[model samples]
Target chain A: MASFRSSLPVYATTLDVVWHYAFRTICGAILVFLVAPILVIIPLSFNAESFFSFTSGMVSLKPEAYSLKWYRDIFTNGMGAPEAAFGWSWLVDSWRHGQWMLALRNSVVVGVASTLVATALGTLASVGLSRPEMPFRGLIMGLLISPMIVPIIITATGLFFFFSSVGLAQTYLGLILAHALLGTPFVVITVTATLTSFDRSLMRAAANLGASPLRAFFSVQAPLILPGVISGALFAFVTSFDEVVVVLFLAEPDQRTIPRQMWSGLREQVSPTILAVATILVLISLAMLGSLEMLRRRVERLKTETPI
Target chain B: MTAVELGTEGLERRLARAERRGKLRAFLLVAPLLAFVLLSFAMPILTLVRQAAYNTLVSANLPETTALIADWKVDAPVPEPLCEALVREMHAAKEVDPAIPSRIATFVNRERAGSLSRVKQVANADIKAPYCAGLAALHDDWAQPDIWRALKIVAPSFSPRFFLQALDFRLQADGSIRSQDSNEALHLMLFRRTLLVAAGVTLACALLGFPVAYLLAHVSLRVSNMLLIIVLLPFWTSLLVRTTAWIALLQQNGVVNDTLVALHIIGEKGRLEMMYNMFATLVVMTHVLLPFMILPLFSVMKGINPNFTRAALSLGATPSTAFWKVYFPQTIPGLGAGCLLVFILAVGYYITPALVGGQSGQLISNIIAFHMQKTLNWPLAAAIGTILLAGVLLLYWLYSRLVGIDKMKLG
Candidate 1:
């Protein structure tokens, strides 16, 4: 009987070991599944062939034989290249010569302008909402933030009609306004969280020292809130840049953002140029993400060192 | 004794003055935002919702006729005499504006078509008055099944037909809520598809994010914060760029397949179905949404003391058991909050799936978009949108109930 009881535990222990190994293996495998597609797409962006699949030479282990011809084709326009092998020579030439650059520039311009505008408006709104002295405070904040909760499709539709009525439809100004409106909520949320940690007493101290309210704000308050504002601005910029639905309703073809351009290209044409564009985008995002990380760390450092 | 020191009149007067100044300043500070929201957001939505129920074209053009049939019930085909009245009113409608026929045609076509097409044409032709006489003289077939179909579709009075259609239900000829079959269907497959896709994406985010967040919280703060930003960086760039970047990396000839082939992980003959598939959709969506999950989990995890695990361990529990029983349960609120927010966001997402999902991968929002932009079915689109809004709100309510949202800590 003692042996039977002891043997049962040994069996259970073996089962437990198997279970642990299986669970870890499965979870890690899933993590790979999660991370692989993202990592895999990097090399596919380098394929020399026009087809989405690999050719014999492209997949070979030897790095020496692999050509940067696809990258080159993506960067420069050569008129004399034979059309015999691949169907996308014109696309290759166009992409190489810098037409995509214009689209990229337009996207950046729109993203930047909208972000700046949203951050400014959102900051003012957040400040007003934060003040205890402001009346109907709850109601006003709710109203201001309602835009975020509403369906973007509905917002897009409303913007379409509203802009069309004012003749701002299809204009860059219209797209900017639409993006700004949508992007403002993120700024408000981020800045409000930052403002919560703010010491109202610090402002009073500056005032007691005979600093005017404006000076107190600029000298003392602004520096403390600057990190929040910057984070909010970056969020807004990214929000505007990545937005597609509202842009689809509001932007003309000429005003196509990179997303809008990618959307059209995906729907109308399937090409490696898109892949090239995606790779560049990934690189830019990684760099931006890295910088944002640095900013966040700096903020954390400030929080710990300054006690307030 | 001290209370008696101040003069009552002086204190009251001072209070009144302060109140007046406070009120004025509040107005000054608060007015623009109220005006902005009222004018820019609230007014537009009110107008859109109003249009969704009853559009201006129907009210202004057929006010008299609508008033005549205002009490018409759904027991039978719109009264035959009402149809005649509509035919006459439509004639007058054309005189007011040539666009009435097309407008009315939209409503009528939803029901019977062939019979109603002639009625629309007659209405467009401006054949007014002694309308039965006009109808007889015209000898047009306005009593056929198609005409009734068209007329019924365009019929007035704050009908719930559009709303029903939006939910993928249609008001049958019998006026019952019935499942739409192939022949007479208004499929909300896309909306449901959007919801399903959104759920799947949210699940993926949580599944991947929970472990990473657990690692960050339990591990050293330095490493945790580093991974946190790595998680947040995509959030800083425009989502458009990140999504596009995924496309490049995932495309057939894209980096992933190239690497795999080079490493001989998979044979070179077959290409990975990297882009424009469910795998691509989930991959890009999860990448976009991972930060949302991580941030909330991190904040909640930060608040949880390490002692709970140690206490459990001291009680002779295994480390994994201690962690799961004591630590994981406390993080549920964050998990719920993160999942709700990400799922809600994903449900409404259009761009990522549209670009990466290909034809088979398209979700419901894409259809709603098509209806809004391409088909110009404003009422129908509004109906669909209203349903989507309701679905999101309902899900949020369920989440709040399940998770006790007030307790969820956020970054």
Candidate 2:
């Protein structure tokens, strides 16, 4: 019964013990592979030097080896008169002139705009698709979701040709529409999932109690399925916020978004400012992941409390 | 009529009417998004495919030259009419738009490099009639037959030459198709590498994901939930953040090399070249895509009844035998779904490869981007995209068939 491998049973052969340990090692390595690259840059983003690598000072955990310079550079890089005293005017200057700030505003505007459009449409379609009476459900779902599955390059190429021909290329509206198209599937899937689990008898009960279809929906269906709608919107936001290829094809110099900015930063130059931005993005995603987990548990609780 | 009096047929008709009305209401709900997708998403893709077959680059700007060279022999001396058309087109190009000549220059310049200055010089010159003689007088390069041939190739509003170029085949002057000569294998090589990388990533994902997924599926609920977060957190993370992290970790003066040096495992001079090579591409991509492989496989593995494997273990079968013969077969659907999803994704991958995959790691998508942005060869770019799109959609179709896409999940 003496054993180094806790998971292996006493009757297991020597080969079983070896295989069991080896399996654990492989799984451990794979987990590390998944998580390490993401965690490795957190410390590096705070590097005192402009270099992407660690310094001896950093390795030795010297207090002076960490700095917030790159984080400041995100605001100061393209700001006019960045050396001016910090004030409301500095905030205004950053809003107007800072390159990364402009990209941040553009990303937020585009992400919110696209998420709103895609979520509205996707939720509506999902409602229809979830209806038992819906026709050609498979084919329509395929068409709606095809954008997510298609290689982004093909979509970008097509958009370049189509948008340029239609005079929509390089416009903010065009980029929003492109992102909305890409984000639609996520919204559709998530919202549809919540709707599929929704109990129909509650709607029937509301109707039986003299509630109008619209009123019943707003009161009964809306509250119960709200988590899916919100999660789907979040998904759409993240999809648009992280997207760059279509933006690269469609956006003009001024219409740059965060991902587009990071793309150029990575390609034209590998600067630590990008690492700083990435660190912020990682924090945002972590927050989103936490909220999604909570929403998921909420949905599960609601499901269990509801009758069949 | 009362149901008892109406009988079966009437009842059936009434039910059908109610069903149709429900269907109408449902269709109305979806109609707006359907129209939007059809007009925007589907139409743009169609436009992209159309570009590969028909383009207006030459026919729009070089109308006169295109008309004049419609029937010109490639091997023969430059005709007077063709020269006059070129002169007239160049002369009128300024009035139409000053950039037209350069556009034409770029269109033909790609075919034969030196033809740009010849086109520009003739456009700038105030040469009088005896236009053919004037063209010859302007420069000896202008007298070349190859310039005329370049015009012939690009002149048409409709041509399959782009697709030909994409496939590493060229249309000869005599209207024959032939393979591009040696060293012109750039397109073919890219196609090969795209598929190879996709396949390799799929295989690597399978190897790495299988154990992790199995462990998640088999473990206690509390342990599995904790491990699942470790898997899903990365999925929620931004892709560029992750790629940058890899660069920081793998770069020569980065943490990994520094650690190796500190440990005396390798000398400072012996630091490995990892970032911007195929090694980085495969490793980074495998890391990025591992979650995709694991999630679907884990979902499938979770559904499997443990007793089936336990029964096999209790029987004559050894642990490995039980795994291979009984347990593995049941995970095929999940494995198939994960593999196809990863392969489809990997095939069209751009961001990871572009960032990590240096020159040796560049895929067809990068080349396509180059043509679209830098080279400005829209037709050829469209052709390559069409090829890549076709492959991806085929695998997607296979995925839908093998594992219904509705069954696809996200965490």
Candidate 3:
């Protein structure tokens, strides 16, 4: 059976080459599959046509002929703004102008507010739990992480009821608090992981030299873990920004999030304006995530470069 | 408060005192979370549990009757006291809201299903005679078997009937628990299907991710880093955007079909079915979760020493055998971590499935959403939510036991 390999059309050299390349190509193709849908939205957003189809200009890769009509429609109602009923003028106008300036503004506000609150609380908890002698650290960690593990849908459902009962259901503060609660787990996990790499001896050395604990923490330890804290903060931002299900259950028309808006648009109607919005969101999220990743890599590098 | 600052105490003794202080500090740190959990999480759960039992719709609607009939027995007729209570309560309910009868009828009618005759018997009965007026003064026997059964079903202060209803089982006319629908299939089937879909998505992710992870791990760092960026790129986008992008690409007149038609894969006939189907759901879900699997596996594989396969090969094992026997086992923990994380995540996924899957692909969570939002069936939703929570906790417990969580990392 082994000797019969020579009878095949391909030689051993060919077989070895083909087999190795096949898996690599397959991997590359799978990666592309995972990413292409997101990438395609960029071009689709710029198409001159009213429909989802890529026109001849877009297909030929000629940027000059392509229209920013969608972008214009997104803002300033370039396509002659569709008349919105039921006081949904903001959504309709947003769809028309190809402009997400307001949504972006709202998202940033919500995301930043949530990130700050979540990160502060998470950092405090992580710091307090950082010491080895802390009692019930495991249980505290479990409770902190429970919000992350319990399905968001379940949490959203329960929170909707709870918030509604308390008369805070659709209020901005309620949504912000919910987002912060949801975003806290990411902050806690990332900060705790960062804390694991902190060299306590440096802090102890500083304290021994008559530096206050707070001073030592700021001057010595904070510098080392700042990257983690920043990355955690960014993670919190992303968590709040991209969150949909909970926001769907909680946010009102006045407090409509981009994701919730997108959900309504997709389900209620199909429009290219959503594609434009999506592409822009993709760009922003990519920027945020790229920086977060770079910071994390820096932390990793710092950990490795430091000597015992 | 440095331990060194303390006078006359030895280092270890001071350290122990510091340790005690640390414990106190930790308790103080977690006190807020404890309070939040007790008020937010614990109270909500308790409320959900409370909602699962006791028939309060009628009682809340007729407060006077509920108060008067607090000690009323099962076989007792409409006593004068209860009749007066019912009249006052009904009048009060009507005064508060003229729509109380329809609401009360909805509640009462829910209690009597498929036994309209039995329900009518109770509705028409009158026991007031000359003592009271209106409903009570009619002087007819209103007590019926179906009403009694409905009352009995709801009599328990903490009934598991919501759980049963959540599973699509309900108390039947004969008082035996049976399927809610005549089809005899429980909604557990939906939960099972959701699990199956989740499992399928996880399996797909693992299969597709393993090769990519292996390639990335074994490749040059420059190549691997580039590949890693490509893998990480998807995380930078919103899930809603990604899902909608698939719709743009997969819809009937969308890019995919347009390309396929151009390439002669199919005439326009096969386009419409692709977008709102199970295949689209599985594809989108697998795409979304692939990174989750690959990142963990890649990190684990990167940490694995390549010499194991070489070591096996030097001992005369075939290349395939060496790879299978030596290399694969080292990645089990990573595989388990990825599988667990991806499966658990995919099972709870709501939006992607709802947007793409439509009717056929809706999961248990979608149904839970429906009950909570649309139907206002909080008890049923809570029951399902509790079941799902239990399932997740059990899975986590199983996973922790099977592979120590401390050693496993999720990306």
DockQ scores for all the models shown? 0.27, 0.76, 0.49
Predicted complex 1: CAPRI docking category: acceptable
True contacts kept of 3: 0.50
Model 3 score (lDDT): 0.74
Sort by DockQ, top down from the best: 2, 3, 1
> How far does residue A269 in candidate 1 sit from its true spot (Å)?
1.3
Question: The CA-based lDDT of model 1 is what?
Answer: 0.69
Query: Each model's TM-score?
Result: 0.82, 0.94, 0.87
Q: What is the overall TM-score of model 2 with all chains considered together?
A: 0.94
lDDT of 2 by residue, B1-411 (tens): 777877887889999999999999999989989998997899999999998998786777668778878878777777888788888777787678888788888777867777888877878898878998888899877777887787788788888888999999987655778898778669999999989999999999999999999999988998998899899878988888888889889989888988899999999899999999999999988988999999999999999998998999888788779999999999999999999999998989998989989999898899999899887888899999998898888888888888986887787
Clashing pairs in 2: none
Estimate, for each residue in B165-229, the C-alpha lDDT of model 1 and write its tens digit. 77667676435776655664544667667777888889888988887677667657776666555
True contacts kept of 1: 0.30
Worst 10 residues of 1 chain B by lDDT: B402-411
How do the residues B288-379 of candidate 3 rate in per-residue lDDT, one tens digit apiece? Answer: 98998998889889999988887897899976898788999999978988899888888788888889987777888888888778876677
Give the winner by TM-score: 2
Candidate 1 residues lying further than 4 Å off, grouped into runs, are: A1-36, A53-56, A61-99, A133-143, A149-151, B1-38, B69-92, B115-117, B123-130, B133-140, B145-149, B172-181, B184-192, B234-284, B358-360, B394-411
Model 2 segments more than 4 A misplaced: A1-10, A13-15, A81-86, B1-10, B60-68, B73-94, B120-144
Measured with C-alpha atoms, the lDDT of residue B372 in candidate 1 is 83
Model 1 chain A: weakest 10-residue lDDT segment is: A1-10
